[model samples]
Target: MEIAAAIQRRGLLFVLSSPSGAGKSTIAQMLLSTDDGIAMSVSATTRPMRPGETDGVDYHFVTDAGFDRMVAGGEFLEWAHVFGHRYGTLKREVMKVIEGGRDVLLDIDWQGTQQLKQVDPDIVRVFILPPSTEELERRLRHRGTDSEEVIARRMDRAASEISHWAEYDYVLINNDAEKCRELVHNILKAERLKATRRVFLHDFVRGLIG
Candidate 1:
């Protein structure tokens, strides 16, 4: 049998998207918390600050005029208007992080993922889904923050959002949080091993052969 080629490690751009109550953000947080080499992409938004939110942390809160200026300058890698608010990722920041030999993670919506893919097809897109509609409703209600009317609206929106799961490269069902996190971790590890991304591998192999 022929010997398999060894691969090299390379930085990656990871995009994780999901509907409300699907646990995408939770999983993303866990991954980042566990991996020091991965950086979360901070988005710029036109939405008002919620309780305990800080500018440049949760988001770079900006006025509509500022957002417009950034868009006109083509500074955003991807952006979308969601729930009547605009959110976007800065292209330069993400590039800088990846170029520094670290993986960058984007917690965005389906629209933003699509836009990112258009700009960089190498982005690894993963979609998270709740196990079931009943389970999703239960999780939403369990939050205890939303009123009944708000919860109902969220459940309705979740159905429409999850229908686009097929558009993602990987679909993860959040049945067990630990298992789901492992699945995402495996995907990231595998993507980093792809030959095209690991350009240094060829040189190392040539050195060994010589």
Candidate 2:
């Protein structure tokens, strides 16, 4: 048998971060649906649970004080305050998934990605940017029913977020969403086959030689 066949691999944290109007979440959902080995990392939040949302499924809802305590105790791998609510990833839970040789997909912002990188430097970071600033604004306006002021604020935030594209490992210009999705699928497949991530490769090779 080939050594590659025998080597067991470790999973990676696949992160996708983008501006407010970019299709990060849509891409993430598409990835999850297509890839059975990867699972979405449910986040813990301090916000009130909305209708039809389940605990430990949609989000692990907690009190604001409890969230503060978790942050202070360093229980979260990454946490961020978004639109007046706190959201975080539980380090223990994510570690468990990674150890099981199944990838975890994270749809988060640049700040959260930075925090996650500090904890797990081996994570694969991918940033998706709209084809152009004008296109991003158009997408935002088309999707949101908010007032002009809110939309303008979102546009400003998108500009600020796009400035961090240089920080990511891979940057994809999302001119066409379907094409971008295929590109991301290819990236993940390549990352999964990386020799460095195959922790049992050495032993498997030795066995094959012996």
Best by TM-score: 1
What tens digits encode model 2's per-residue C-alpha lDDT throughout 171-199?
99888888888999999999987889877
How many clashing residue pairs, candidate 2?
Answer: 0
Q: List the residue pairs that clash in candidate 2.
A: none
Q: Residue 164 lDDT in model 1?
A: 84
- Looking at model 1, the pairs that clash are none
lDDT of 1 by residue, 1-210 (tens): 011222235677899988878898889999998887689988999988987889988899999999999999999999998767899999877987777768999999988988888988888989999998888888888878677987888887787788888999999999988899999999988887788877776776798899
State the displacement of the C-alpha of residue 76, model 1, in Å, after optimal TM-score superposition: 0.7
lDDT of 1: 0.86
- Relative to the true structure, candidate 2 reaches a TM of 0.87
Model 2 error, position 198 (Å): 1.1
Native-to-model Cα distance after best TM-score fit, residue 52 in candidate 2, in Å = 5.6
**Backbone clash numbers for all candidates listed:** 0, 0
Model 1 compared with the native: what TM-score?
0.90
For model 2 the local lDDT of residue 129 reads 93
